[model samples]
Target: MTVRRPAAALASLAVTALALTACGTDQQAAPGEDKIKVVASTSVWASVVQAVGGDGVEVEPIIKDPSADPHSYESSPQDAAKVTDADLVVLNGGGYDEFMTQILGSSGQGKPTVEAVEDEHEGEPAAHEEHGEPAGHDHAVNEHVWYDLPVVQQVADQVATELGELRPAEAAQFNQSADRFEQEVSGLQGRVGEIAAANQGKQVIVTEPVAHYLVEAAKLQDITPPSFVNAIEAETDPSAAAVAEVQNVVNARQIVAVIYNPQTESPVTRNVRAAAEQNRIPVVEMTETLPTDKTYVQWMDAQITALQSALSQNR
Candidate 1:
């Protein structure tokens, strides 16, 4: 995807770079500031940090707007300053939020950073290759790893470990909080398992693969044309044949539901949604970040619930 950094954003970044040079390498909290300052790429990861850190850390998400697309997000000087000042930084990584990666790279502060994708699969090969799929298609290593509950659990544990190292006095508390968060994640996983048991192999379609991992967890088959998914992710129009194939699938009601990502909606996707609605096929909404006033667990739980409801209603 093309990321256009505005001139103002570049100027802000330059100012932040200068400020960091003046401040030197000190990344500690200010006097009397007890909370560990945590900066996350989006509210999804921020919610995870908040759950594990509890009262011990003050978390800030750079992309808090629900409608904002992380792929094309423009970073400002304040965002860079946040990364420079943060004791710990959390990111989804895997090229999903290149803006955060850019800020972290430019900050040069060497703060403790936890990336959900890279850190979760530290020793494993590239996920798409491991699955024996091409890089950018249906079976690719989806960077939206937040939809993968097991990965989320691993990330939470890492967050606790990182926080423990920062404030050794509260190490045990952080671990305990992560333990509790894991239990909740386990509960969410169980729900996904239930969906799998009830509707394994059920066919569905998506505008983009934002919930690829979640759909996989439930053993649902995403019949979205690979070309269509690739084009949507690349922010380009799919070939005429690809678009026609997807429309045919929807018109025929061949899929159980249409998994739609409204955040990345386009005219083509909108037309697909309209076709699904007209055919009375369910359209389940998923997003890249947390919805308003929701914790990570709450957000995933709600999506899983919606998926189950969609399947049952179609049945």
Candidate 2:
């Protein structure tokens, strides 16, 4: 169910991405015809678009460094250039890429954009700030919606719908990709359910809450204090109280597993990892960008495996 892309294929995708970073792919346009130029706000969004659009569509990725925290990214002139020519844009809305909205809107292209937010789309509130502001709600919506299979399905659906509208002749291909993509998401949901159900309610701690939705899907209860969560979300190191509470939680063996954002890790996360180790708990380190070789489900299955291992160690 979880097919791993061959390294060769990934290498090819990477090269293709690099070569076409600033231009549309030739495969996108027919002889003497124009192609649909699109700008995806993040690499994750771009990947999802590529998954659905395949070679029929051309996407100019705004964020080249997939490892950088999208929450704090600034738009470059080049980024604006891409949006200006794009017919459509895909955004991880939930405060994930607010900077993009302005850039794309002002492009004179009047490009239509799809915002994949949590409410009725993903689940919970976005866990972090977008462009540095709270998502205007309290539930920590998983801005990393691409990691959440259910919401990811919604995102793919929205994308396919828009793509279909843009090029009706290619609607069948778009619909096919959407169907396959949705099936993959459903399969991932089942796989994650299998793993999470095995250790439901086990407590876990997150450094940045980047993949909290997947963690919750794995049935792991986050023992990371809301204060600490807020601190990391706000991009400010935790206050003394939050740090102390988090340290205590780590030291107290309050959680069985610890997961961290390797890309934007802080000393506080390192401390949490140390505490987990001191307590002999296992830790899972991950990135905001999903692995290139993995489908969302496979990547999540790997995380659950880490969780299962961590929970076993805790016991």
**In candidate 1, what are the lDDT values of residues 1-315, reduced to their tens digit?**
111111112222222332222221233333335898899999999999999998889999999998988988999998999888887889887778888878877883355676765422233223233443433365335788888787788778878777766676677888999999999999999999999999999999999999988888899988888889888888999999999999999898789999999988999999999999999999999999888788889888898999999999966
Q: Residue 315 in candidate 2 has what lDDT?
A: 51
- What candidate 2 gets wrong by more than 4 Å, as runs, is 1-34, 118-140, 291-298
What lDDT score belongs to each candidate, Candidate 1 first?
0.79, 0.66
Off by more than 4 A, model 1: 1-33, 119-140
Candidate 2 residue-wise lDDT at 20: 27
After superposition of all CA atoms, the RMSD between model 1 and the true structure is 7.8
What C-alpha lDDT does candidate 1 achieve relative to the native structure?
0.79
